[model samples]
Target: MTYIRTVLGDIEPADLGPTYAHEHLVIDGGRPVELYPDFDLSDVDRAVAELAPARDLGLACVVDAMPCSAGRNVRKLVEISRRSGVHVIAPSGLHLAKYYAADLWSERGSVDELAERFRADIEDGIDEHDYLGPVVERTEYLAGVMKIAGSEPSLTPRERRVYEAAASAHRTTGSPILTHCSEGLGALEQVRLLADHGVDPRHVTLSHTDKVIDRGYHREILATGAFVEYDQGFRWKAGVDNGTLTLLAWLFEDGYGDQLMLGMDAARQGYWTTYGGEPGMTFLLGEFAAAMRERGIGDDAQAALFVRNPARAYAFAPVAVTAG
Candidate 1:
C-alpha cells in the first residue's frame, strides 16, 4: 500500500482526499513572526475552531508549510490534528534565509548535518522544542514532507544550501519536497537546481507560482514535470478577472491539470475567521469551487486539483532508503 506520512501517522494515499497542498495552520512566535507580526498563528484552540468548518467542507488533509524554527510547532500540529480529526502533514526542511538569524545553526551547518536533522524529523520525530532553544526533546509526532524556499529572479547561496539539505533528506527518507517560489519567479531555476541534486521533479511541488500571470513562464516550469501549487485564488476581487482563475483555466485547457494543485497559503492572521478575517479557510471549497464550476471547470478537473494531484504529488516514492 502506498502510504503518506502525517503528523499523526501514515495513511493510505486514498485517505488524502481533498487536500490543501500548501498551508500554515500554526505559527508560534519566531523570527518569521518577529519580522512579520501577521504570520503568528499560535492559538491552538483558535486554529482547531477555524478548521472545523473547513473539515466539514471535506478538507481532509493540510500540508503545513511552516517548518522548524520558523514557528513550526509539532506538538501543536499533533493536537490540532487529533482534536479536529483532519490529517496534517508537517514540513521538516527549511524556509527562506530571512526567517533564520545570522550565525544560526542552519546557516553555519554543513549540508550533511542539516540533512541528518531533517531526516531525523521525518523518519524519526520532530524536535519538541521546535528548534527554537537548545533544549530538544524528540516527540512521537513526525514530519511528513520536506520544504525549501528560493528568492525571486535567482536563488541566494544560503537558499541553495537549504535546497541541497532538503534534497538529501528527501532522498534518504523518500519524503516529498514542497518549495516556495518567491512571486512565482525562479521556479525554472528551482526545478533545475533540484534536478542537479538528483531529486525527481514529480515529487517536488513549487508553490506560490500562481502569482506570476505569465502563461509562458508556467508552461516552461510545467515542462520540468514539477507540480505547481496555486494559492492566490482569494486575492483577486469579485467581478474582476481573477488572474488565478484565468491561469487555472488556461493550464487545465492545456491538459496540465494532473501536475497542478491548489492551496490558500493563508499564513496571515487576517485570513482566518477565528482571528476575525474574511475569506475564511472554507472560502476555497465554498466560493472558489463554485466559481470554478461556473467558469466551466468540471467536477473532474476540480477533483484533480483538490484530490488526485495531491495524492500523487505527495506520495512517498517506492524507492527504499539503504542504511549505512
Candidate 2:
C-alpha cells in the first residue's frame, strides 16, 4: 500500500506498470565548470524525448537513478513523464564522492541531519510552499532509494562519510539503496556496511554491473538477494561480442532470472545515432527479444526476463497477457 506523489498526482505503487528499474533521465560527469560553457545540458525536453522509443516498445516506467549533483533534474522529469505516459521515478539522494563539491559537504550539517532531510522529502515534500520554506522543505519529500559510490575497492574517508549519510537516510526514511560502483571493488563492501547499519539487503540494487567480476562474484551478490542490473542497451558492436547475452544465459541457467534486469545506460548525446540504437527504452527490449529468438530461446524464458522479472522486482503491475 505504498503511495508515490508525482507531478501528475499521487498514485499507488501498483499503478507503476512494467518498469525499467534502472535508467537515467539526465547525466553529467561532473566535469569542470568550463566543460559546458552554455550549461544547457540540463534540458528536460531532450531527456524526455529519449524515452519515446521505450513507450513504443511496451515500456511503462523508468526509474531515473541520476542523483542530485550528477545531472538529476526532478522538475523536468515530471514534465517528461507527463509527455511520455511512462512513469519516471526520480532520485533525491547524494552522488559519488568526487562530485560532492566542498559547499555541499560543508552544508550537509551531519549524517543525522542529512537523514532527517531525506525523510522529510519522502514523508513531507521538497517544495517550500508545500512544507513552509527551505528548512522544512529540505527535510520533506523523501527519496525512494539512497545512492552512493566509490571509485576504488575500499571506501575513502570522504566516500565513507557519504555512505554513512546514505545509511542514515535509509535508516530514517526506510528508503532502499542503489549504488554506482566503479571497478566493482567497494560495492560489496558498501553493501556490507549498509547491512551493518541495519539497511535491508533485499532493498538494495547494485547497478552498472557490466564490469562486475565474472561468474563467481556475480552469483555471490545474487545470493545476498540484491537486484543485479545489466545495463548494456547502448552497446551494439555485435550480437556475439556483447556480454549481456552471455550473462543472461548464465543467470537463466542458474535459476537467477528473477533477480536480473536490463537497461541501456545510454549517456552520450549522439550514441543513439550510432550503434543502430535509438534514444528510447524500446530499443533494448526489442533487441533482447530479437537476440533471444535468434539464439533459439523461447518466449516463456524471454518473458520472464523482459516483462515478468522487472514488474515483480519493481513492484509494478503484472504485465498484461497478450497473444504471441
RMSD of each: 1.2, 7.0
Estimate the TM-score of every prediction: 0.97, 0.80
Model 1 C-alpha lDDT per residue in residues 1-324, reported as the tens digit of each score:
567999889999987899999999999988988999998899999989999999999999999999878899988999999999999999998888888888878888988989999999988789988776778788988898998899988999988998999888877778899999998889999989988998899999999998999999898899899999999999987688889888889999888989999999999999999989978899889999998998888899999999999999999876674776
Which regions in candidate 1 have their CA more than 4 angstroms from the true location? 321-324
Q: Which parts of model 2 have CA positions greater than 4 angstroms off? A: 2-14, 27-41, 106-108, 127-142, 273-280, 296-298, 306-324
TM-score, prediction 2: 0.80
In the predicted model 1, the residue pairs found to clash are: none
* Per-residue error (Å), model 1, residue 200: 0.8
Could you say which candidate leads in lDDT? 1
C-alpha displacement of 129 in model 1, angstroms? 0.9
